[model samples]
Target: MGESVAWVAVDWGTSNVRAWGVSADGGIVASARSEAGMARLTPEAYPAALDLLLTDMAIPAGAPLEVLICGMAGARQGWREAPYLEVPAELGGLALSAVEPLGTRPGLSARIQPGVCHKGVGSEDVMRGEETQLLGLSRLLPGFSGLAVLPGTHCKWAELDGRRLTRFGSAMTGEVFEALAQHTVLRHSLAGDVVESEREAGFDDGVEAALARPERLLSSLFRVRTGALLSGKSPSWCRGFLSGLLIGTEIAGFRNWGGDEEVPLIGSTALCALYGRGLAAIGRKSRIVDATDCTLAGLRAARELL
Candidate 1:
């Protein structure tokens, strides 16, 4: 057998699958991806899709694949079912049982990291794969203890106590936004692109409107469509207005839940900016970090245990 030269790291989500070939020191050597996301696969089809990717990449047949995966790939419908680790647990200490691929080729082995569950006052939330990034962030910013916001289909507001994820709350913000923008009556009242100036103005207005009466969020949201139809408000501006309203509602909810005084937002640049803008309008402070970096760092951290 030839000497091992690469490691495989995967970030498998609902709609897409991303794989990276990394050097022993963690530099990405090459990468390949496919549409074989959890959303599009059946339990019986996952192993074949994974094998195709690895084989196409020419990953050595017996190099001890050294796989570390995260995201919905570990969920009930993905490769294998991994349980959730409850809160107040050391991120690095969590583990998942070894997962052996069916119809395995020579020398292929894998492991899937489990998700996390946090139970707090009046709230219970869960996350898969994100915990690794949080662990990576904690490692990068040692002694960092504050709120970390990860925005996606299900946005997570995690309370970090050192390298441990103590508690967190989940909001179906992105999914809700997508559904309202495309599948509902609200779609007819919004424009394609939202401008920066309008986003800022709308965001401020939204923060004020939401904070004035948090319970009236859904009713206030309908006003976007009503105002556009009845008063001839520009659809583009109304789109931005709707964006602001949703963000504003999130900010208000977080504020009510406490912990905004010293929170740092972590996600893609665009998402971080939007969240930061909305929070700033509410007179709260926030810092943004690159989501990709954290994911890579987290993948590397997970490999260490192997």
Candidate 2:
């Protein structure tokens, strides 16, 4: 029954949970979302949170609904620990490693897919949600190879050889931006909303400054405040400048990892667009993949294997 419900897919992150009703043909029939993410819930609370999200769905009675999930829900502090599979792992193998959470509701089966762990690299890193998205990307571009950059709170740059993930590195760019804008002196420099053109210009300028002289990152950050005071730059410009500087520095480091090729950027549309700009600044190209589509495809891919 291609038109009937086949299963459910959930991307449960730290701040939000989004679910999709997938049909037998892999198309999404319905969807739901909630703010009860892993960061704010205890293990005991996971079931209720999920129940609240699924209560209004149109799944048929007595149907065997398989709920496949990815992201922080599999973390040690999340719903249940889905131990990470080490790198050089095949993207399609995630389904075999899925772990079922205890205390799930009756008549509803759920499996949380494990994230990937990379050790012998730049940083001892772990990624839960992104691995699933990468799986989706693999399905989207069959036999694809190269780097996939997923930008967000903790940006990840993963190198893929075919469907196998070779190695990866992460950057705390987004988190750092939030910290600087809220806790540091830079907050004063980035105070208000900016026009679209001014934001883009400020962002581009920051990218150029960071790439041209990365060693002076700290000093350049301070210049945001100084520029605001002396040059009378608006807060929006300062904010855009700060964003570009952080993102550009991150890209400058990663662009040289492989070659200056078209990298696949996956994440939220806005964040991916931001990373795309930063990539272009480094003479690199990027293809944006909608984060939700990747997550859904990844979940469906895992479900099919099961």
Please provide TM-scores, in order, for all candidate models, with all chains considered together.
Answer: 0.90, 0.94
CA lDDT of each prediction against the hidden true structure: 0.75, 0.85
Candidate 2 lDDT over 37-120, as tens digits, reads: 888999999988887767656555445578889999999999899999998888788988989998877788998999999776
The sequence of per-residue lDDT tens digits that candidate 1 reaches over residues 219-271 is: 98888888788987666667777777777787778875435455567777787
State in Å the error of residue 82, model 2.
0.4
State candidate 1's TM-score.
0.90
Off by over 4 Å in 2: 1-3, 60-63
lDDT of 1: 0.75
- Go through the candidates in order and give the clash count of each: 0, 0
Best by lDDT: 2
